[model samples]
Target: MGKLTIVAHIKAKADKIDLVKSELLKLINTTRAESGCINYNLHQDNSNPAHFLFYENWESRSLWQTHMNNKHLEDYMKATEGAVDEFVLNEMAEIDS
Candidate 1:
């Protein structure tokens, strides 16, 4: 298996933006410390405060999967249950030139 790149977009409910952003921020430190995590960065849209993006790179898809199943992720889900309006995730392989 090769490196995996994940692009995740999260849009918070208008009224729940703060809550969702906090919960999403909580994932950073822990996720960055996880094995095989090369990088995990969070971004908020300049014009849209409720929009968030997570740009991540992992050593492998399996390790990324492991990270997905971690307790913190589950906690994040529980914490932001109804706070999110839209979520999209994309997994890709870097094209080598």
Candidate 2:
């Protein structure tokens, strides 16, 4: 019922970095426009070009789940099927001060 933070780490296959990065980039604008999306940011590892991370915050878990089932997300999964080598996702709740 509270805010949700998501940390998603995606590592592209050595030969598919560009493809993966581009596909990942496609999610930003669309995701940012989604309801309940507070922020959707993407980051690439400085030393590892093939590594990517998405830092996201949503108003609620329900909304975030809606985002996960979106068409664009499905497309991204299809587009980057074999291009990614590793994927990890973490969902957390911010500690109140």
Candidate 3:
């Protein structure tokens, strides 16, 4: 099976972005050190400072599932529960790229 791509589009209060982004960066670094993580990244939208994106890749869907159950990931989510106004998660298949 191919890698699983997870795109987390997060939009929080204008002032909360720094907090959210910092938390996401920790998650990304932790994820990258996991057993099956291929890559993990956090990015901010140039036009919308309050908007952020988390791009993560796992070796397999099972690995991704494992990541969801990871303590760090759970802790991160719990810490930022209501800090966001909009949280959109998207799973993607890399057709050609």
**lDDT scores for all predictions?**
0.97, 0.98, 0.86
Q: How would you encode candidate 2's per-residue C-alpha lDDT over 32-95 as one tens digit per residue?
A: 9999999999999999999999999999999999999999999999999999999999998899
Lowest summed lDDT over 10 consecutive residues: which window, candidate 1?
88-97
Candidate number with the higher lDDT (1 or 2): 2
> For model 1, which pairs clash?
none
Q: What's the residue-level lDDT of 57 in candidate 3?
A: 82
Looking at model 2, residue 75 earns an lDDT score of 100
lDDT of 1 at 24: 92
Q: Could you give candidate 3's per-residue lDDT for residues 25-57 as a string of tens digits? A: 788667788999888888899999889988888
Please report the TM-score between candidate 3 and the true structure: 0.90
TM-score of each: 0.97, 0.97, 0.90
Q: Mind giving the per-residue lDDT tens digits that candidate 1 earns over 1-97?
A: 7999999999999999999999999999999999999999999999999999999999999999999999999999999998999999999899982
Would you give me the overall lDDT of model 2? Answer: 0.98
**Cα displacement (Å) at residue 28, model 2:** 0.4
